[model samples]
Target chain A: MKLYSYWRSSCSWRVRIALNLKGLPYEYVPVHLVKDGGQQNSDAYRAINPMRTVPTLEVTEGGRVHRLAQSMAILEYLEERHPSPALLPAEPFLRARCRMLSEMVNSGIQPLQNLAVLQRIKAELKGDDKAWCAYWIDRGLAAFQEVALETGGTYCLGDTVSFADVFLVPQLYGARRFGVDLQPYPLLTRIEAACANLPAFQAAHADRQPDAVPA
Target chain B: MKLYSYWRSSCSWRVRIALNLKGLPYEYVPVHLVKDGGQQNSDAYRAINPMRTVPTLEVTEGGRVHRLAQSMAILEYLEERHPSPALLPAEPFLRARCRMLSEMVNSGIQPLQNLAVLQRIKAELKGDDKAWCAYWIDRGLAAFQEVALETGGTYCLGDTVSFADVFLVPQLYGARRFGVDLQPYPLLTRIEAACANLPAFQAAHADRQPDAVPA
Candidate 1:
């Protein structure tokens, strides 16, 4: 497997964490989102992922290659293909809850603040991109905190690391980068602290990636 | 089971289609998103789903009730609990493709044009909300069409009505609402026409819902 990723992309980070959690080794092929007019938009990259997004997992199975995009889709595929050391709860309802919380971050938060959207806000709308990102991040994290309060223990789903935690940790990293005040989301911060102690989460942190540069 | 939904919400409509497809009986409890300052914001509704989003599936099982939010999560749960009449492809790679296509609409298109985000664009950034919606819808749909060209057949994946089709139909409805020119996306429109012929798609149309008021 080869992962085409940008070091600081939260979506890419989510997949990195999942791969580590599943203990699946994959070659990291960086797609610089900000360098040279965003390499993700290059014709070559677009051929691999028509969406021109990062974290496209190129997998070879039975000598047939499949390149998959969309972080939630990639995560779900990982969970399905490599079920052991499960990232979701075994119970049906719990699994649903895990996915629900993950989507809270996935669809609800990340999309609004991604590079393309922010560029549109700046170039087309002439809006303050920072304020736009901060608004969505704060709103999303607050809601995530409210829901996590009911479902969380040491992790987002009661002492076990699940997809909820996978989604949350990267989003919190994004929240900080956007300068959104994380002070209001104690539950989420607590869960982040807990996840920070783990080797997988640590390994997946953006700064540790080969392509990461100094901020 | 009961579904908390608004007639025109694409996310809610996606879940409605999935429920209908699986032939699962669910009472439609409308949560008029635009009336009474959005009933989804009501304390009662927020208690059910702290994210305060529509398409919250309230289910009763073994004398316990579970309220699940996020349309994708609900669809996956329904698939897990009732595997027959599957909304996902059987093979893992195909399933991943189905989900990747679904997310092209779910997180990619829908989130950028939803009411809350549009309201923010209008109120906060003082931008033309309609233009914002059109821009995203066009960009997302173009990408969807590009990928669907490779993967789609009679449906999004070779005559099978998977989650990809469930997501695409509602989004095309939304695109037309936003005045997007659909001529460029012949492949997607073709698939939409195929999906429209299905009874499940007809039952899940926004105008067909009980809360729907004529445009």
Candidate 2:
């Protein structure tokens, strides 16, 4: 398996954490989202993922290669295929809650502040893109904190690390990048501190990636 | 089960389609997105879902009420609990593809054009929200069409009415509402036509909802 990723992409980072959690090793192929007008838009990468997004997983099984994109889809595939070290809870309702929390980050927070949308704000709308990103990030984190206060324990769901944690950790990283005031989200910060101690989350940090650039 | 939904909300419409597809009878409890300053922002509704989004599914099991939000999460829960008429493919790769297509709209399209984000664009940035939505809807639909062309046969994943189709139909409806020229996406329009003939899709149309306002 090869993961086509950008070092600082939250979506890419989520998949990286999942792969580590599942004990699945894959070759890391970096697709620079910024260099040369976003290499993800290149024809070569678009063939692998027509959406021109990062974290496209290429897997070879039974002499056939399958490429999958979208972090949630890839995470679900990983959970389905590698269920031993589960990334979701056992009970149905708990699993649904876990996914609901994950989507709060995946669909709710991340998409509005991503590179392409920010670029559009800058080019087309002539808006303060950083402020735009920060506004959405702050709003989303506050809502996430409200929900996590109910479901969280050692992690977003409970003592065990679930997909909610997988989605939350990277999004918190993004929140900080956008200068979102994390002070309001104490529960999320506490969960982040807990996840920071885990080896899987440690290995998936953006700075540790092969393509990471020094600040 | 009761669904807190708003007519013309694509996310709400997606879950409505899923519930209909699974033969699950759910009470449609409408939450108006644009009446007297948006009822989804009410204190009562926010208690049910902190995200303040529509399509919150309230389910009763063993005397415990589990209210889940996020359409993908709700769809996954329904599929897990009631697996008779499956919404996913049997093969992991195909299932992944189906989900990949769904997320193309779920995360890629819908979030960027939803009411809250559009309101932000209007109030904060003073931008032409309609043009912003049209741009994103066009781009996302193009990406969906490109990927769907590869995996589509009758539905998005080869004649099966999977989650991909469930997501696509509402998104196309949103695109038309935004005045996006659909001539470029012949394949997607064809799939829309196919899904339109189905009873589930018909039952879940925004115009057919209890709270739908006459045009």
Work out the TM-score per prediction: 0.99, 0.99
> Model 2's DockQ?
0.91
Candidate 1 per-residue lDDT over residues A6-48, each given as its tens digit: 8999999999999999999999999999889999999999999
For candidate 1, list the clashing residue pairs, or say none.
Answer: none
lDDT over C-alpha atoms for residue A1 of model 1 = 93
Please, what are the lDDT tens digits per residue for candidate 2 over residues B1-215? 99999889999999999889888898999898998799989999889998999889999989999999999999999899999799999999999989999999999999999999999899988899989999999999999999888888888888889999999999998898888999999999898999999999999999999999957
Compared with the true structure, the alpha-carbon lDDT of candidate 1 equals 0.92
Give RMSD (Å) of candidate 2 vs. truth.
Answer: 0.9
Q: Score the docking of each candidate (DockQ).
A: 0.89, 0.91
What lDDT is obtained when candidate 2 is compared to the true structure?
Answer: 0.92
**Model 1 bad stretches (over 4 Å):** none
Residue-level lDDT of model 1, residues B53-87, one tens digit each, is: 88899999999999999999999999999888988
* Residue B115 lDDT (model 1): 90
